[model samples]
Target: MMISEVSEKFDIPQDTLRYYERIGLIPHVNRNKSKIRDYTEEDCRWVEFVKCMRSAGLPIEVLIEYVGLFQQGDETVEARKELLIEQRTQLKARMEDMKKTLERLDYKIARYETGIAQTEKILRRPET
Candidate 1:
């Protein structure tokens, strides 16, 4: 598909797609005779993977390294597995921290809700 189609399908900006290709994040995209990017299924998959990893807070540098290793073929299979395992470990730690933060936010919101309910009760009481 064309860049615009890929951008729309992935909900990513066209410029960011270009940047990803330029940075070796998504690998080289094949260009058509018109000099326009023609993304294959594999290209789309890479884009999706990168977007997911980035959203999960994986560092760009780490992803670049992973992609480089991936391009090196079967000889780097063990290396790739190790890289993913390390990234998964770090991601789990971040998820734990985020869960704690979410709990704190929920606590604060519940407190405010309880306070509002109590105020409403008082306001409904008949004035002496």
Candidate 2:
């Protein structure tokens, strides 16, 4: 299929797809005589993977490095595993921080509710 088809299928913009290809996030796409990109199923799969990584908050630089390693054959398996492990660790730490922040917000919300209830009770009393 063509670039347009791939973009429509993946719900991604055509320009973004082109940018990804230019930046080496996805492998090189075959070109037709008119120099237009002709994407194959494999190319589409890579594009989908890239979209997933981006959605998961993976940095573009890390994706680029992954693509490079992927193109270099199977010898970089350990390095690739290490990269994923490091990212997982960072994500875990971020999740922990978010949990703490959420707890603080919940506490503040409960405190505000209590204050509002007390104020309502005071307002219901006979005026001085």
Q: Estimate each model's TM-score.
A: 0.96, 0.81
Q: What is the alpha-carbon RMSD of candidate 1 to the true structure?
A: 0.9
lDDT of 2 by residue, 41-87 (tens): 99999999999988878899999999999899899998998998998
Q: In model 2, which runs have C-alpha deviations exceeding 4 angstroms?
A: 125-128
Which candidate has the top score in TM-score?
Answer: 1
Q: Would you give me the overall lDDT of model 1?
A: 0.96
The alpha-carbon lDDT assigned to residue 23 of candidate 1 equals 91
lDDT of 1 by residue, 35-96 (tens): 99999999999999999999999999999999999999999999999999999999999999
Q: Alpha carbon lDDT of residue 16, candidate 1?
A: 97
Number of the top-ranking candidate, with lDDT as the measure: 1
lDDT, candidate 1, residue 115?
A: 100
